[model samples]
Target: MTSEPITVVLGSASPARLRVLRDAGLDPLVLVSDVDEEAIVDRLADAAPEHVVTALAQAKADAVVETIRGGDDPLFDAARTDGVVLTCDSMLLLDGRLSGKPHSPEVAIEQWHRMRGSTGHLITGHCVTRLHRGEADAATGHQSTSVRFSDVSDTLIERYVATGEPLKVAGAFTLDGLGGWLLDGIDGDPSSVIGISLPLTRRLLTDLDVDIADLWRA
Candidate 1:
């Protein structure tokens, strides 16, 4: 007899994150968290960048956990058995300041202008929640990657911003997308720069006694 596959719930709306997991072989049911990010940041305004991202990722995971256990949404109870929830939050720490999605052309343009010829650490916080037999537990961690940007001309930055890609991602750049050409190089996990660190996620899952391989789609 064959055993049932474990359900994997993703608690963020980031397409990049989703793509990362899917491309890695785990099929997850996306359950975007509705948590107020600004509120979370405001509450942890004095915290360090790592602490901020960790708290944000945990908050998002907790919110999704509530949604899954609070009701009878058929989709939420995908497996009706053991499962796991994954959540992540990313930010760019540059020149002693941390920033998430610029969200505006002007802001993105400004971010790129400052980022050109500079290096920043991309910190991605991760949380993995295990749900087994009506009980839930979580483990969390983070990864940081040093990203160096090319000293491109103003015209290039302006043109990139016009594409509107940078406005929707953290650090105003992507390692695997249109912004790839703007970078000189990186000194850490490339996946973390994209959004989630596979190595870190594996460790977090192991901490929860969940084997990543067991969660992979057949």
Candidate 2:
């Protein structure tokens, strides 16, 4: 590891992912990628949820990496020297169907109706692009968590949907937000369910020969 700390370039606009990293002691520079998620998902219509999420995450990372390589933005100068671009995409797989952000109140309500009292697999793909010593390398992986929803009533679902939280998040629920009240339990990493998997991220950083500790805030 370099004596200098590695900067974290978060290639996502998700507040949840940024919070996850910040709470874990790493301060990340947020860079939102303009990748068309719906287009990518449509292109991989028949692929497994794991593969789809991974492809989406890689696409986002690649987009941001291109911007960093352009060298036009002084914001990325530190990142170009010794930084890791981390991107993630998450979806909920239920009954062989994949669902990303509902993006609509009606869709959120429908998703909750189908998910209430049922279990869904929350899969989050992670991609890490390391820019160190003028060379860039990447590693990708995913984490899957089984989340069980409570037998919430329609009235409650309607109330939750009114809050508009479900419309902006995958699975129409969250373990660390207002939706937490509607979830019974989770069988995997809770951090992944929130947005990013700390353990999986650590392993990916290891693959790129960067220690997670080296990326921690001073």
Worst 10 residues of 1 by lDDT: 73-82
Clashing pairs in 1: none
Best by TM-score: 2
Candidate 2 TM-score, C-alpha based: 0.98
lDDT of 2 by residue, 1-218 (tens): 56887778999888999999999999999899999899999999999889999999999999999888875788788998889999999999999999999999999999999999899999999999998778889999999999999999999999999998998898888899999999999999999999999999999999988888888888
Please provide, for model 1 over 8-118, each residue's C-alpha lDDT reduced to its tens digit, 9 standing for 90 to 100: 998988899999999999999988888899899999999999999999999999989988888688987753357899999999999999999999999998988899999
Distance from true location, Cα of 42 in model 2, Å: 0.6
